[model samples]
Target: MNIARPLIQLVSWAILVSSVFLVKALANDSTQNLSIAVGWSKPPYVIALNDTGYEVELARQVFKRMGYSITPVYVPYGRTLSMLKSAKVDAALTLSENTATQTIHLTDSYIQYQNVAISLQSSNFKIKRPNDLAKHSVASFQTATKILGKAYADAIKQVPLYVELPDQRRQVGMLLNGSISVLVMDVNIFNHLHSALEPIESRQLVSIHNIFPPSHYHVGFLNSELKEQFNRALNDFQASQAYEILVKKYHIFQEALSTH
Candidate 1:
């Protein structure tokens, strides 16, 4: 046997080992990059990509602990659902149980949203129950009817003037300017929007009635494995001080709104 034959065999083995390692490293890198869709721009939840709100930060931290990186893709509320169904994104954030379909696997609820019926204090609207909304000119965010449940949808349908707007800021302006008798939205969102108004306007114009119960939100994923992974990561994050720090950073607190 030629002595060079053994050396060539050794070189081939080395090349094969290196190729395998390279492939594995690339696969691991791909798995670590998670693409997620974020629908709403509500502050303290999702302010922007740079100033990512509390909820966004929470998700980021959870994924970070799981050895994954998050790429947040902003879209409208309705488009977020479509993207998940089409598998355009690995996951969608801030989805409710009512909004997720059977094809989508949802992670455990990580946050509770306090939704309220708000109007200008001057209007003196009374919304003790869903039925009370039937008599008012109402405006809400897109898909609010479905996410809020059938009772809300039915009651809103009876109103002579009911519209769903994509822009929460516009809804606030309409409520303040007498275009809508009442606006149904999360209390935090109202606070965020109200903060932008003039000092006197913020003080005297807006009022909120705690008519709706709190809604729990979750992340929706196309893959069940990813959903389970997120749930475990979320549980871990919740048990850590990092979660508390994020909440404080975003100023996510329940502040009593002045109601008539």
Candidate 2:
């Protein structure tokens, strides 16, 4: 009937409309679910089971604004990287330079600071200055290696680094067990862990006053699509004063290590 060309055109238009609807529906579904990787323990920035833990709440609010339902996975800092590298997770709470994954995209600094060494209260190691640790063995996470390096020049001799602990609570464990003369950690994190993780004998610990290696913390994403969305959302958070509230809420950059 010589009607093939018109029929084909009509069919093509119908297919285009159907495809558009399908894409929109899929995108909508995706927006409702967001799964992220976070460490399982509390203290040093993230607290498990605490409604207001910095990393947990930050992830919840950030993703929620992007129209995503939050899925929080509790894992160690090292495993967090593994999850992102394998594309098993969508995002992570804290991103460090040590992670070194090519596929992971990072955003601007969401948190930043220096970590200090603390001794058990009985140890009497006063950290009143930076170089005071020239004769002590220091334990720290792998991510803290560079940060520690900036503080001590011949760091290998004075500051010995133990392997990264599974979580921040281990810093206290090492101190209690005498595995390390002192442990280096961000002050805010040190405080967070001090109050929430475990009950340490009050007389057994003391944190140094001197700070070391001022650093910045960042948020990370696995895919470019989510990365772009988070960056935009983070900017809005800053502009809307929510970032300030978060900083105060989490006490983000403020050091909480006062000799107690």
Candidate 3:
């Protein structure tokens, strides 16, 4: 027997055993660092720049309670799905049970967004529900087609000019200038960032249509066991006084904010 061949065989066996143990160790590690995928600069939810926003911090606290830490990966809303599917990241924020990402496990509804259809008051558009949007041009956040349900999806297809983009601030300008017939967004999101994002050229009154129901979003995970752990932690976090402080910190009320 060649001495080098036997030694190499021994080393390979050790490596294989080590890998198995490592996998088991990580599976049981409570202080694990998770790579979480989240979307771009939507204030009060995801302020991607400094890497700290309402949902971001909320996730941090929830994970912290479980002795886990999060490393947020900022991608566009649409990319979050792909990232999760490809296992490029560990989890995705703001996904719902309705999101069509196959093999992805979802947590309980941790956050709710009051999404609305907004148009200029001058247009006199009577958009009471999603189907009413079929006749007009619309701009909305990325993945709105998937998350807002089938009725909204069908309406978007009928619209002559419908656009969904990651930069929601630009869509606000489009709605104000009459370039787009409607802008679909969360009520708190528009309220928190409109003054800074709106164009100086257009100063127009807006009509908010509560066409869509409140969207309850969950965090997504590729690992099923991790999902169970997260849900347990989330339940504990929600019941704690810390959770109340977090909601108030972000100025997010349990009741929908007045859509004026």
Candidate No. with top TM-score:
1
lDDT of 3 by residue, 21-88 (tens): 99999887857889999988888788888887789999999889878889999888889878998999
lDDT of each: 0.83, 0.69, 0.84
User: CA lDDT of 248 in candidate 2?
Assistant: 82
Model 2's TM-score against the true structure:
0.72
Question: How close to the true structure is residue 89 of candidate 1, measured as C-alpha lDDT?
Answer: 92
Which pairs clash (backbone N, Cα, C closer than 3 Å) in model 3?
A: none
> For model 1, how does the per-residue alpha-carbon lDDT over 21-74 read when each residue is reduced to its tens digit?
999999888658878988768776887748488888888899888789889988
In order, how many clashes per candidate? Answer: 0, 6, 0
TM-score of each: 0.86, 0.72, 0.81
Off by over 4 Å in 1: 1-31, 49-51, 200-202
- 200 in model 3: Cα distance from truth in Å? 12
lDDT score of model 1? 0.83
1-260 per-residue lDDT for model 2 (tens digits): 78999999999999999999999999889768767788666553566675447667766777778889887887876677778787787777677765545677887776666666677767777676657766677766655654456555455356555445666677767765788777777677676666654565553446565556566666678677877888787677667676667768766766454552
